[model samples]
Target chain A: MNRTTTEKVVKSLKQRHRKEKLFKAAGFASVCFGFLLVLTLISDIVIKATPAFHQHWLKLEIDYQQEWLGVDSLDYEKLESADYRKVLRRSILAMMPEVSGRQDKRSLYKLVSNNAEFTVRDALLKSPEFIGKKKNVWVMLDDDVDSYLKENTEFSQTGIRISEKQAGWIEQWYNNGLIDKQWNTEFLTSGDSREPELAGVRGALTGTMWTMLVTLILSFPLGVAAALYLEEFAPSNRFTDFIEVNINNLAAVPSIVFGLLGLAVIINLFGMPRSTPLVGGVVLTLMTLPTIIIASRASIKAVPPSIREAALGLGASKMQVAFGHVLPLAMPGIITGTIIGMAQALGETAPLLMIGMVAFIVDVPMGVTDASTVMPVQIYLWADSPERAFLAKTSAAILVLLTFLMMMNTLAATLRRKFEKRF
Target chain B: MKKLPIILSLIATSSNLMAAGRDTISVVGSSTVYPFSTVVAERFGKTTDFKTPKIESTGTGGGMKLFCAGAGIDTPDMSNASRRIKKSELEMCEKNGVKEVTEVLVGYDGIVIANSKATKQMEITRKEIFLALAKQVPATDGSEKLVDNPYKTWNEINPDLPKTKIEVLGPPPTSGTRDAFAELVLEGGCEQFAWIKAIKKQDKNKYKAICHSVREDHVYIEAGENDNLIVQKLTTNPKALGVFGFSFLDQNSDTLQGSIVDGEKPTFEGIADGSYPVSRPLYFYVKNAHVGKVPGIKEFLEEFTSEASMGEEGYLTDKGLIPLGEAKLKKIRDQVLSFTPLKL
Candidate 1:
C-alpha cells in the first residue's frame, strides 16, 4: 500500500509539472503575439510611407517665351492670365514631335503635372530675368509617371492613366538619365491640396502646435490647482468625495461625449468660432483635465509624510508646507503625467471633428482662432481622399504623428527615472 | 466675493463682442458639397469685403437636422446637400418656425465605379453590379425566390468577364454618394427584373430589402467616408474597385479609370447631359430669415450664382462640377438672387 501511494504521488507531481510548462508557454505566446502585432504595424506604415518621401522629376528645356506668356515685364495681372500651359505643351511636344493628333498630344502632357505651369510662373515671379530665357529645368513629374518609375506599377497595365505612347516616351526619358529622383521637401513645406502632389502637412502641423500649446497652457495650471486644493486643503466630506468620484468617472467617459459637450456648451452657448484651434483646444482641455487631475493627485499623494512634518516643525504655515515642499517633490510626476495626457490629446480625432476642426483649410494657422486641422484630422482627411498618392502621404503623416507620441512618452519616462524620489 | 462682479461683467462683455460682429456667414452640410462651397467662399472672401463663410461638413441628415432646428443669427445661414430636402425635414422646419427656405441647385456630381490604372477597365452592366453586390439576389434559374449571394468571382456572374475576384470598396450608408448610387444604379437595375418590379407593387418594404441591401461578405468592403483609402487599396490589390465622386476620378485620371456602366462611359460630357447612369444634383438651402440680418449672406449667394462661377466654362466646372443646362441654370440663379421661398 505504501509503495502504491508513493507511485501515485510521483505521477501527480509529473502531471503538475507538465501543466506548469503548458501555462508558461501560453503566456509567453500571447506576449510575443502582442510584440509581433506592433512590429507588423510599424513595418507596414514605414514601407508604404517611404515612397512618398522621394519624388520623380523630368528635366526639360522650358522656353519662357514672351509671346506665349504675353508679358515682357513683371505684370502680376497679365502673368496670371498668360497661357503658360501652352508653353508647357510646346516643350513636351518638342521632345516627341513624332506623336501627333489631339488625343496623343493630350496624353503626352500627362508626363508633367497640371500644376507644372504654375511652377514656371512662380519661377518667373521670383526672378524676372528668367522670363525671356530658355532654361533646362527639372520639373515635377505627374503622379502616374512617378508610380510607373517606382516599379510597383507598369506602363502596359490595363486602365493605365497614361497612354501607351506617353508611357513609351517616359520610359525613353528615364533610360536616358533625364528623369531624376529627388527628396520631396515640398511635402513638408506646402499646405493641403486636392492634388496629392501639392498636398503638404504644414497647415496641419501648425494647427497641432497651436492647439497643443493652448491645451497645455489651460489644462496644466487649472488641473494642478484643483489637485492641490483637493489633496491638501479641501475637507474630507461627502462633497469632496463626490467630486473625486466624478473626476475619475470623467476620465473614463468616451471622448465623443466631450465633443457633444463642446458643441453644445462652448460653440452653441458661447458662440465661439467653429473649426478653430481655440475651440479645439478648449474641447481637448476638458477631455484631458480628468487625466491631469488624477495624475496630479497620485503624484501629490506619493510625497512623503515626513517632509510635511519637517516643514511644519520648522514653523512653516500649512500652505507653505504644501506648496514649497510637497509640490516641488511631486513636480516630476506631475509633468510626466501631463506629457502623457498631451500625447493622448494629440491622437484624438472624433472630438475635434464634432466641433468643426475637420474643415479643409489650405493656409497655415496664424493664431488660435484660424480655421485649421490637427495631425490626426489631417490624416483623416487624406485617408478620405480618392487619390492613390494620398495613401502614401497618409501613411507618412501617421509616421510623423507616431514619432511625436513616442518622443513625448520617452521624455516622460526619462524624467520619472531621473527625478522620481523614493523617500 | 470681490471677483463676482468682475466675472459677471467679463461674461457680459464677451457676449457683447460676439453680438457685435455677425459679419461671417455660417454654412454647413454634406462633405460632397463642402469642397465646392469652400472654393467659392475663399474667392468671395478674397475678392469682396467679407469674412470667409464658416462651412462645416455635417453629413446630409445631420445638416438638415441643424438647419431645421430654427431660424436665428446663431443658426447656420445655409445648408449644402447632395440630396433634395426630405418631406419630413420640410415639415420639421415649418414646425420650428422656419417658414421660408430657398433651395439653390448648384450642379451635378457623377458617381463612378473606378479601379486602379493597373487593373483592366471593367465593362459592367448595372445588372451585374446589382447581382454581385446585393445581399440577396434572385435565383439565377429564373425562380422568384431570393437567396444569399453565392457569386464570388466576376467570371461566375458572366463568362465574358475576367476570372479575377469581385471585390468592391464603397462608402457606408451615411454617405450621400452611397444614397445616390443606391437610388440611381441599384434601383435602376432592380427594375429590370419584371417579377421584382411586380413585387414592388405588392410589398414596398420587401422590395426595398431585396433591392437596397448590400452583401455583408468580404467581397464588398464598407470603407467609411474616406474614398482615398479605397483608391489606395485598389492600387495595392489590383483586383478591387471603388465608388467615389467624379472629381476624384478627374484628379487622379493618371492612376485610375472609371468603369463603363450600361454601355455608357462616366465622362464629363456624359454626366453633364445625363447620359451617365449614376449622377445626382447638389444643392444648398438658405434660411430666408438670416438673409438680410447676416452681413455677407446676399453677396455670397450672388457670388455663387453668378455666371462666372456656375457657367459652362466657369471655375466650378474646372473643379469637376458638371454644369447644368443653360435653362435650368438660369432658373435656379434667378430663384436664389430673388430669395424666392421654395414651395413645399
Candidate 2:
C-alpha cells in the first residue's frame, strides 16, 4: 500500500511542477512574440523609409542660351515669358541627350527634369537679361523622378517616386547620360513644406542650429552663474532651498505647458513673432535652464573641496580659487551638462509649434530673429502631410535628426570621457 | 473573469451588430464640418433611432485617404472637405469601389486674413501678401532669396494699402485652413500673374513650388490650427496678421479685425457677391450607406438642407460662419436631400 501510494503521489507532484514550467515557457514565448512584432514593424518602417533620404539626379547637358548667359539688370523686367522658357527649355534639353528627331522629344524633355517650372522661372527671374543668352546649366530634376531613381519609393511615376514610365525613360536617359543618382542634401537640409519633392530641412536645421546657439549662449552662462551662487555662495537656507524646489518643479513642468508659458510671456509680453527662432530659443532656454542649472550645480559640487582649499592656501581669494581651480575641474561637467541641455532643446517641438515655428520657411534662418523651422517641426510637418511620399520623407528626416542628436550625445560622452579624469 | 468573458462576448456581439441594416455611417474629414454634423446628428438621433454616426476631423486629405480606402470596415461613409477634392483623390475613391459619392457644398466660409486690432488698418494685395508670406517665389532675377519686395510691400503689391509688415500667422500644413489658403490665396494669387500662371500650367510642380514658397525666413509663419493662439498673438503683436477662416474673424471681431485684401473686406455679403475674393465653400459629405442603420445621419443630412440649419442666422452661421448665398445654399441642400445610392 505504501509503495503504490508513494509512487502515485510522486507522479502527481511531478505533473504539477511540469505544468508550472509550461506556463513559464508560454509566458516567455508570448514576450518573444511581442518583441518580434515590434522588431518586424520597425525594420519595415526603416526599410521602406530609408529610400527617402536618397534622391536621383537628372543630368541635363543643355547649352545655356547665349542670350540669357550672364543676366543684366537692364533686361530684367523686359524678359519675356518665351525668352525665359526658351532658356529653360534649352537647358532642360541640354540636360537630356539630344535625339536625332522628334521621336525623342517627349521622353527627352521628360529626362531633362527638375520639371518644376518655378526653379526654371526662378532661374530666369535671377537672370532676366539672360533670356536671350544661353549656356549649359545643370538643374535638379523633378522630385518624382529624382525620388524614384533614388529608390525612396517602389519606383512610382510621381510625387518624389519617379513614375514607372519615367523610370523606363530614365533608364535609357541614364544610359545616354541624362538623369543620374546624386546625393540628396535637400532631404537632409531643407525645411518641411507642402511640396514633398522640394521639401528640405535647411530652414529648420539652421533655425534649430541658431536656436541652440542662442540657448547655449543664454542658458550656459546663466545656469553656471546660478549654480555657483547656489552651490558655492548661497548659504543652505530657506530662500535657497525654495529656489531649488522651484527649479526642480520647472524641470518637471510639461513641455507644452512651457509652450503656453512662451506664448503668454515671450511672444505675448515681449511681442515676439510666433516663428522667430529667437522666441523658440528663448522658450527652450527657459525650459532647459533648470536642466542646465541642475547639471551645473551638480558639476560644481563634484569638484573636490580640497582643490578650493589648496588654491586658498596659496593666498588666493575665494573668488579666484572658485573661478580658477574649481571652475576648470568643473569644465567637463559643465560642458557635458550644457550639451545635454542643448540636446534636449534640439528635439523640442511643442514650444516651437505654439510660437509658430510649424510654418513653412524656405531659406535657412540667418539669425535668431528670422522666421524659422526646426528639425523636429520639420519632422512633425512631414509626418502630418497627406502625401504618402511625406511619410518616407518624414522617416528620412527622422534619421537625420536622430543622427544630429546622436552626434551631440557622442560629443558629450567623448568630452566626459576625455576630460573627466584630466581635471 | 466571468464578467470579463461576458464583456468580451458583448463587444464581439456589438462588432457583429456593426453590420446593421445597411445603416451604419462614418463621415471622416474636415473639422470645419464637424459642428454642423454634430447638431444634425442630434436632431436626427431624436428622430430615426438608427445607428449613431461617427465623424472624424482628419483634415480634407486625411479624410479622403479613409474615404478612398473603399468599401467595408475600412471604408468611410462620406468625406467632408473644405476644398474641392483632387482628381487623384477622386480617382482613388473610384478605384476603391466607391464609384458614386454625393459631393455637397453646404455653406460658405470666406477665408479671412485677420489680424490683432493693431493690424486692422493694414490692407494688402494678393501679390504683396503672397510675397511676404509665401515659402518662396519665382525671383525676377532667378536667385531664390527671401522676397525683398514682394509686390514691393502693401502699396507696391497693390496701390491702396497701409505700410505694415507682412508677418502672417497661419495654420500648419495639417489643417483645412492650409488647404483653403493654398487654393484660395497662394494658388489664386499665383494665377493673377500671367507668367506664373503659365508656369503653373506648364509644369504643376513649378506652380506648386512657387505656391509652396511664399518666402522662407522673412515671410509666413506656420502656425498650427489653434486659431485662439493666432488670435492671442495677433492681439499682442499688432504687426502680425492671422490667416484663418471667417469663423475665426467672426468670433474674434471684438478684439481683431478682418484683413482687407485688394481693398475688399471679407464679409458675408462681400463673399456672396464675389467682392471678397478669398471666399471659399464649406462642405459636409454624408455616409449614404449609413442612412438607414444610422438613425441620425440621414435625418441629420436632411436637416442640414432645411432652412433651420442654414438660414442667415442659423446655428451654423452663428458659429462664426459666413453663410453662402441663398440660392447656392438651397441648391446644395436640395442636392443632399435628393441624393440616392445607385443600385450595384
Candidate 3:
C-alpha cells in the first residue's frame, strides 16, 4: 500500500521475468545442440557412404581368341579353367597399343579389377554363343580406379594411390565416354569377399532375417505365455515376486554376457554348431526374452479389469476370458513392444561374435544351420579391413543399418498411434 | 500357458536333432597369420575331402594361451603366431599336459611406416624416430639423464627434416606389430645412446621399459586393430603417418607411400633378404595330440608347407607374405614333415 513497497515489488517482478527468459533460452539452446549433433552424425555417414552405392565400370572389347584362352572347345570345364587372364591382358593391350613393357602393362591392367577374368569367364560360361566372338562388355573397374573416379582424392597427387599415368588414362576414358557409373546392386545381392569391391551384405542380411525369425518364433509364444500366467493366473506370492524381480534384472545384463553364455552353454555344452544363425538366434532369443516378457506383461496389465469380468460374467471360463478378451485388447501394445525388441536384437554384434559368427563367410546362407554373419558383424569386419575402399563400405553399412532401425521404430510408433486405446 | 508346453517340446526336438562331432580342425591365433591360414584352409577344403578349418583371429598372446590350455579334442588343433612362443608359454603348456607341439615357420612380414601419398616422402633414421616417438629421451644436450620427450615437430629431432608436426597413428601395445616396431626400430635407436645400451647390461627389463615405452602425448595415437581407419585418417590429414603391415602398403601404394627407415625401403625383396630392418618371421604351432585326433590337421599343415604355398612365387606371396629362400624353405618343410617338436 506504500510507495517504497510498490517499487520493490515491481523490481522483483522484472528480475523474475529476466530469469525466466534466460532459462527458456538455455533450454532452447540445449535442444538445438542435441539436434545439431544428430544431424552432423547422419550427414557425415551419408556423405561418406553415397559413393559406395555407385560403382565405376569400364567398357572394353574382348576378342576371346581360342589360343589366347587355351581353350579349343566350349566345354564348361575347359572354359572354367581357361587362361582368361591372358585374354583379358591381350584385350587391354589391344585397346592401348602405345603402352609397352611389363611395368606399364601391369599399370594398364590395374585399370580393371583382378576379378575381371572371372567375370568374363562367368559371362562366357552362361552363354557359350559368345565364345570365339568379339564382344563389348562393361566390366567393373578396380577399387582404386573407382575411388579416383569418385574424386575421393585430388587428381594430381603424385604419390597417392592413383598414379599420374593411371589418372591420365582415366581422364582420357572419361573424355571418350568409356567410363560409367551405375548403382552397385551387387552390394545388396552378393555375399562378403576379401576384396572390398566384391563384398556384399546379402549373406549378413539373410542371416539377420533367419536369426530374427527364430528369435520371434521362440520368444513370442514363450514370453506371452509367461506374461499371461504371471499377470492373470499366478498368485502374487513370494515366488512370483522373485520371478518378476529376476526378469527385470536379467533385462539389464550387458549383451556381451549373454554372448559368453551362448558360447559356454549353447555351443560348448549343448554341442550346437558355432557361427551358425541357429546359435545366433538362440543367443538373441535369450537376450530378448526378458524384454519381450516385460513388455507383454505391461500391455496385459494395461487392459481394464472390467473386460475380464464382463467375459467371465458371460459364462466363459478363465482361459477364454483372458485369451479372448484381454489378449485382443493388449495385441497392439504387445506387437509394438515385440518390434522394438526385435530391432534391439537386430543391431546386436558382440553376442554373435562370441558365438563365432565373425568367420569370413562368402556364401549366402541357405539355411539357419549354415555358417553366417549378421549386418553389424559384417560392418565390424569391413570396418577392420585394411583396404581404403572398405572405409566407404563401412559408412554405407551404417547408413543401411540406421535406415532399418528407423523403419522398425516408425512401424512401432504407427501401430501404437493407430490402435492404442487411451482407456 | 498352453503355448509353453508346445515351445518346450519344440526346443527339445531341436536339441535332439543336433549332435556333437569333432571332425573339423580348429585354428586360432595372431590376426596377422589369419589370412594365410584361411587361404590354406580354403584350398585344402576344395582339393581334399576334409572340412575347412575354423580359424579365429585372436591375438598372438591370446592364441598361445588357448593353445597351451590343453591337448584335447575340445582344444584348438593349431595356433598361428606372429611371434615365437616364449619360455613362460611353453612351461604353461607343459604344466597343462600339452607335451608335444610342432612349430611351423611361415614366411616373414614387414612392419611399415607409411604416410598419405600427398606428402613428401620422409627418409628417417632410427635415432630420429626414437626421439620423435619415445616416452623419454636422453636430454638433448648429450647428458646421460633421461627426460620426457620435448620435441613436437619432426624437424626438432633433425633440422634437416621437414617442419611438419610429429603425428603418428599406430597399433596399441597388444598388437604384435607394435612389439616388433618397439624391438626393431625403438631398441635399434635406443642403443645409439651408449648409456642406455650399458643400462641393458645392468638391467634388461628397465632398459626395455625405457626403450619400448611410447609417449602419451596426442602426437602418438593408439589406433585399435582397425588399420583401415588409420589409412582413412591419414588421407584426411596428409601430414600424419601410420604404422601397418607391408601388405597394406602394397595394396594402397597408389594412395600411400612407405617412409624410408634406416636408409632402406619396406620392399618385399628387402624384407625377404634381411635388408629391411623391421621385419619378423611369422609362425604357427600345431598340437601333436590333435594332429591324429582332429581330421585334416596334418593334411592342412602339409598343404601349407608345400612348395606351392611357401615358395617365393607362391599364392601366399601374392597376399603380401615375404617368402623365405628355397634352401631355408626346404629345411623348414622337411622339419615340419618330420613332426619335430619345438625344443623350448
Candidate 4:
C-alpha cells in the first residue's frame, strides 16, 4: 500500500471514531435528560404528597354526659339517634371559655372536623361505661387546621383558610402539647367525603378493581380467540386483510370514541345503569380489545411453524396443534399485552366521564352495578375541589395511582420472565 | 371457558337487579351547584338511615336532559341548574311524561373576575369590561355602528386602569359561569349604549348575539373547567385576570384577589345582599313522579332545605355557599315541603 493511501485511511478512521463518539454521547445525554425529567416529576409529587399521609389530632377532655347526648339510658336505639354534634361542640367550646361571641364561637368550633361527632358517638356506643365520665380523647382536627399546621407550624402569619384567631388557637394547642400527628387511616379506610381530610380512596380503589376484573374477563378470551382464528385458522384472503387493517385502525382510535359509543349504545340503547363499574368496564373492554388482539396475533405469529409441522407429523389435528403448541408458547406475550391494555384502561378518565363516573359519589360501591368513580377520576375531582388541603390529597392520590401502575407492570414483567421460552 | 360463562351470568344477574328498581335517589346537575348539593347529600346520608344519593356533576343542560328524559326508575330524580329551566326544556319534559316537577330554589353563586395578589385589585365597571372583552364594541367615533375591539391594553379602555395587556382567563361557553357572565355582566354593559338598547327593542336575537359573543382574539383565553389551574396561572402572570366561581377565589384568597365590579366588591355579604351584580341563583328541580318511588327523596329534600344546611350559619356557608334571604328560604322550604308543581 502507498503512504498516501495509508494516511488517507488513518485520517478517515479518526473522523469516523470522532463521529461515533459524538453519537454515543448524544444518546447518553438524551437518556440522562429523560431520567432527570422523570426524577424531578416524581420528587415533586412525593414532596407534595408526604404532608397528606399524616393528620393532626387535637386532644380534648370530653364529658360524655348522658343528658348532653339526650339519652336517658344507654339504649342502642337512643344512642344511634343521638345528637352527637352538639356534644362535640360543647366539648370544643369548653376548651376556650373566653370565646363567647357568635362568630368567635364559630371559629373555635371549627378547630375539630365536622365529622368528629361520629367518632364520639361510636366511642360512646362501644363503651357504655364511659357515660357521664370525663375522658380524654384525641379528636381529629379539621382539614384547615391540619393544612395550616403542616404549612405554617410557627403560626407567624395567617393561612389562606386559617384566620389569625384560628392560628393563635392552633399555636396554643401546639405549645401545650395538645396537638399530635398520626397516620391518616381514614384516607385508606373510609369512602369519599366533602371534607378533604376525611376523603379516602378505598371506594375508588375497589371501583377500579371491579372494573378491571370485568375488563379482564371479557377482553382476554375474546381477544385470544380472535387472534388465534386470524393467525392459525383464517385463510389469507381479502377478508382477512380487511379485518387485520381494521383491527390495527381500531387500536389507534382515540379511547373517548368508545366512551361515546358506550353512552349511545350501552346506556341509551341497552338501558344499562349509568356511572356503574359494569358500564365503565364494558366501555374500556371495547377500547382495549383491539390492542389485545393485535398484540396476541403478533405473538402467535412469532411461534415457529416447525413446531406446528412436528405436532401435525405426530398425528395431531390442526386444532390440537394450534391450541396445545402455539397457545402455550404465545401465552406469556398475550398476558403482557393484556396487562399493558389493563394499565391503559386503569388510567382512563375520559371514557368514564361520558358515562357519569366523574361524579361525587360518597358510598363505597358494593357491586359492579353500583355507581362508582375510579382512581383517576377521584384525583381529578380532588384537584378541582375548592379546599386547600385537597392539593396535597390530589398529589397523594397520584402517588398511589403511580404505585399501582408500577406494581402491575412489575407483575407483567415477572410473569413474562417466568414463562418466556427462548426456543 | 367455564369461568367466562360464570362471569357472564354474574354480570347478567347484577344488571337485572339494577334494572328492577333503584332505591336510592339519584341527583344530576350543574357543576356550579355540585359542591353545595354534595355537602347536603353527605349530611343527609350520615344523619339518616337511607342510602347516600348518587350525584353526578353533569352540566346544567346535560342534567336537564337526563332529568327530563322520562318518569321512571332509570331516570334521575332531581336536576340541579344554575339557571332557570327554559320554556323549551319544560315542554320537552311534559312531552316525555314528566308532567310535574318541583323547582327548589337553592342559594346563589357569585362569579368573580379575579387577579393575582401581586397586582392591585381591579376596580372595573360593566361597560369597561364589555369594551375590553367583547368581540365588537361600540364605535369610538360616537356613531351607532359596531367596530372590532381595538383597545389593546387596560389603560386604553380607561386611563385610570393599569397599563397592562388585557389578557383574561375564563371558562368556555359551555360553562354555567360563562353563561351567567355573558348575561349579567356583558349584557348589562352592552345595554348602556343608547343605540344597542334601542336594538334590543327591535331584534332581541341580534342584541343577544352582539352581547353574548366573547372575543376570539388571544386576549380572551378559554381556560378549561379547572379553576385551580387559572388561579395558579394568575399567580405566575401577575397582569392576567381570571373568571371563576366565588368559592375558588375564597379558597385561594392568599394568592388571588377578586375585582370590584360596578362599585361592589365580591364579598359574601355583598353578593348575598344583591349588591354584587354578577351573582346567579342555583336551583334543583325534583321529578314529582319519583317523589314516592324513591325511598329518601322527600327526606333528602327536607334535609337540604333544613336550617342547619342552608341557613346563614349553616355548614354550606363555610363551603362558600351564600344562603338565601329569610323570606326566600321560607318560600323555598314551603315549596319543597308541599311539592307544588312548577307552573312553568
Per-residue CA lDDT of model 3 for A346-394, tens digit only, reads 9998888678777666667766666678889889878876666788899
Question: Which pairs in model 4 have colliding backbones?
Answer: none
How high is the lDDT of residue A62 in model 4?
A: 81
Please give, for residues B1-344, the per-residue lDDT of candidate 3 as tens digits: 66757755665565454444466677778989877777677667645678667677778988898789777566678888999999999999999999988999999999999998898998998888899999999998888999999999998999989998999999999998899889989999999999899999899999999999999988889988877778778889899989999888887887789999999988989999999888999999989877677778778888999887889877688678999889999999899988899997
Model 1: CA > 4 A from native: A1-32, A58-101, A129-138, A152-159, A171-178, A413-422, B1-27, B34-56, B66-79, B87-107, B112-170, B190-223, B228-273, B284-344
Best by lDDT: 4
Give a tens-digit lDDT track for model 2, residues B36-94.
Answer: 55445443433344544444445677678767766654355677788777778777777
Pick the DockQ winner. Answer: 4
Q: What lDDT score goes with residue B86 in model 2?
A: 74
What lDDT tens digits, residue by residue, belong to model 1 across residues A1-423?
999999999989989999999999999999999999999999999999988898998888888888887776667777665777787888778877798987677667767875687777666666767777887777898876776677545546523355567677887897888989999898889777665676789889889987887798789889999999999999999999999999999999999999999999999888887777778999999989999999999999999899999999999999999889988899888988799789899999999978888766766777676777899988887786655677889999999888877877887788778876666
Worst 10 residues of 4 chain A by lDDT: A147-156
If ranked by DockQ, best first, what sequence of candidates would result? Answer: 4, 3, 1, 2
In order, the Cα lDDT scores of the candidates are: 0.84, 0.66, 0.84, 0.91
Once superposed on the true structure, which residue ranges of model 4 sit more than 4 Å away at CA? Answer: A1-10, B1-9
Residue B221 shift from truth in candidate 2, angstroms: 32
TM-score of each: 0.79, 0.48, 0.83, 0.98
Ranking by TM-score: 4, 3, 1, 2
By lDDT, the better pick of 2 and 3 is 3
Native-to-model Cα distance after best TM-score fit, residue B88 in candidate 3, in Å: 5.1
